[model samples]
Target: MSEPEAKRIKMADGTKAPVIGTHNGHFHADEALAVYLLRLLPQYANSSLIRTRDAEVLKTCDIVCDVGGVHDHDAKRYDHHQREFNAVFPGSATKLSSAGLVWMHYGKDIIASVTGLATSDANNDLLYNKLYADFIEAFDANDNGIPIYDPAALRSAGIEKRFSDKGFSMAGVVNRFNYAATEPRNAAKASVSADAPAAPKQKTQEEEDTRFQKASHFVGEQFVAELLDKAGSWLPAREVVKQAFADRAQYDAQGRIIVIPWKPEGVPWMEHLYNLEEENGAKGAVLYALFAESGEPDSKWRIRAVSLEPGSFENRKGLPEAWRGVRDEELSKVSGIPGAIFVHASGFIGGNASFDGALQMAKQSVDM
Candidate 1:
């Protein structure tokens, strides 16, 4: 099918709004999130949302997602359940759900708008990729019924079991809204089945619409919360981390360690540092970072090893070998730093009772 021309709805105030349509009866996280993402754009900020499966009703909407039979991006029909449909995002093994499909096409613009970062900003791309890896990928994988681990491979490797189950994820929360007193909680389970027909409804159409609205509102709040953290908290820290990286030479003559101003909490420092090094063509030049704790005494500081990647335990440069598995006065004695508190046995990080002690620990690790 060819792409349809965009349609706009005129609000009561005479303002134009996009009309977004999805299936009715039951809602899931993928569709809820997809709708929320569309509204994040300025063009759709006050869009009218319609919940229905009526072919004629969906035809009147500007974009029909997760319900229409077609999966054409140009046509703005984003369903994935057709037997012949086997679409996946470029470079991704998992099939795309409505949420993933929307994100793949519009995530950069949505993230840029939410974070107040210009489309051309370097961090815009970084945040977009990070959000997908950490947040959106699980939605796509779960909707596609991809297993977290291959059970056969695990048994062959002598692994006894996977440690954790999928807990109360966002998808689970959305499904809960469909619950009604007449039906068992499991009734919502059908929402996850790509080809399962919608379960018979126990509630009136008015009641079902109310529940869908609640689910959409809940999902919208979640989207906003995550966006605020990424923008207000994380984006600001990138600047601090970048500056410390650029000034590493002043912190230590060898330019191996960076000392950032105190921060209230940890951010994506490792990722920012790694990206900065790549951009400057000085990969692996930074080894450690020292920063004071906000609202703590000036004597307290944290000395952290720069990880090779975010969420990785491996470090570009670990603490001195002698300091490993040492603590308190003993650590102080061996390290020749009086205020040394402890070094994690894993060598990822350590604590010191004074700024000078932490600085010495990071510098000595670099020298070692």
Candidate 2:
């Protein structure tokens, strides 16, 4: 018999769907935030640090819907001094944790993410019990607990794509890109290079390799620009995209810019992937962890279920079957996003399947 169909859950949206087990199926940041915050929504209305705006936040959400995250004081404003929580819990020291989260909300979907402090190197870098217990206790605190949270200064994390609302793509080095267009806020300044003639070209293998390396670097920079533009703080769009690829810092430093496709490194696949050990020529679990460009933790994220829209598959014959459900089994189970908001991501998987050769083998398995 076909595998038991996904259990559908009823929602106010009028679409009856199966309720995905938060345990069996990973609930990243958005889903985590939604579940956690929804449970706490009834309390935000009475918080002291929360102004009328914070209270409005509770009223605006789906009561039982996803608001992205609690750490996202920038997106869904929270009551900072609510007695228990970090007061500045969502923002404050979370620094890169917040920026990383911003990138996820825009470029990714299928899963969501949330940031947490990992005090123990054990428990595989994900102590769910530790994180959950900490959040709930702090969130429920009453007096000296909330030491510093300013309502006027905070919004949920996934609100904007940047530190500020207005944002733009950035590229420090580019040729095709025009820099002369935007008026430089500062006076014109130019640097001079030594007046030496460039060396003549030789078709040496090393030279060819250097040229290829430069090209790859340029491409990577361009991708970063797109990531910032689409997922910047200004976008205020939920969802996150991350990259998971060969750890070769020399080649792919950003990992793989994947939509939610797999687990973070330490959970299970870290041993094989991190060590690059192909024991007996057998591949290890495919671990894909794409991060936000900003410093914050990834919020909403998921692994894109690559598939054709029914009959559309016949017309788009060239579309790889692997692109749809290729090697997603491992990933589908645990997309790293924690809270509720959702977005789609792809480049991350494409990178890994290309480098690690897992996706390619998976495709072959399906075709056979």
Candidate 3:
């Protein structure tokens, strides 16, 4: 289907399509993302976009964003420009831009639309919170000019960045779509005498609108990609780790050893394991995770030591000291376990040829 037709709803009364309004001229990432996010819903997917600063023109819009000077969800006006506006997403101190405000209201519905999950589903809530923390919060902070790091702390520690990373974010990409701020001055200098004042040459509404659409699509596609990754890959791994943590007793009475049937590449289990431990009211409980090595020709299994904290290199418990840096027949003889492959010098991980041998290694470690 053609793009315009896909975005137009058939009106029974023959009225014009619902209009989503924002200010015209140079655009920023916040309103661009806000418009794209609104378009994801069934009601607004077919809506028309109108960019203007005229109050009368804005009043004609069904929903206005980033220029209305007011935020009223019931009135469908989301703007963060007012003097008293200090609105933020619940539990977050970073100020909301029009993007965060729209997300604060319609984010769950957007997630449900994209992932085919009910808004009330626990998994939907999980994705909603996770996406905001991982993806959306950055837009909010960037648009509001909030720095991610403490400047004073960096100075106090005498820390300096080794490389420049400016303009490397999605927000930076969106900013590049804006009409050049220097174009007007350059045009006036070339076409008119310097002695006389010259009005700046401005892009027509249609030209600016085209750039806005491009910017919106760019940010929107990125948002969807992040959402899909969380739903398709991350959530499944969360379930796997949750179930394994719950079923840990079957592998050992201490409930310190969990078994994973298999591990998928780029799918994490440690973060989930730590969260599950806290949820189960037993922090730092699990010490080891056993899993079959995925797609290996020799049917190898591995036992990994769980860190004392998430993202920490320090393990809660390591494998036997005697087995560290040992391999093959020597490892088998040292550990008295069959089919042993090897153990890292750090003892954070070890390998075996069978699930039984892996489980036996974990149980022996638990005993030690």
Largest TM-score belongs to which candidate?
A: 3
Which stretches of model 1 miss by more than 4 angstroms? 1-10, 14-18, 83-91, 112-115, 158-167, 180-201, 252-254, 265-268, 278-285, 294-297, 307-309, 312-317, 324-332, 338-341, 344-347
Error of 3 at 342 (Å): 1.7
Task: For model 3, state the Cα shift of residue 283 in Å.
Answer: 2.1
Tens digit of per-residue lDDT, candidate 2, span 260-361: 233332122222232232432323223233322222343323222222232232221122332433334443333321221222233222223222233332
lDDT score of model 3?
A: 0.86
Per lDDT, the best of the predicted structures is: 3
lDDT of each: 0.79, 0.28, 0.86
Tens-digit lDDT string for candidate 3 (269-330): 88888878888898988899988877665678999999878777889999989999999999
Better of 1 and 3 by lDDT: 3
TM-score of candidate 1 against the unseen true structure: 0.78
Question: Residues 5-68, candidate 1, lDDT per residue (tens digit)?
Answer: 2445567888666788888877788888888888888777877777888898789888878998
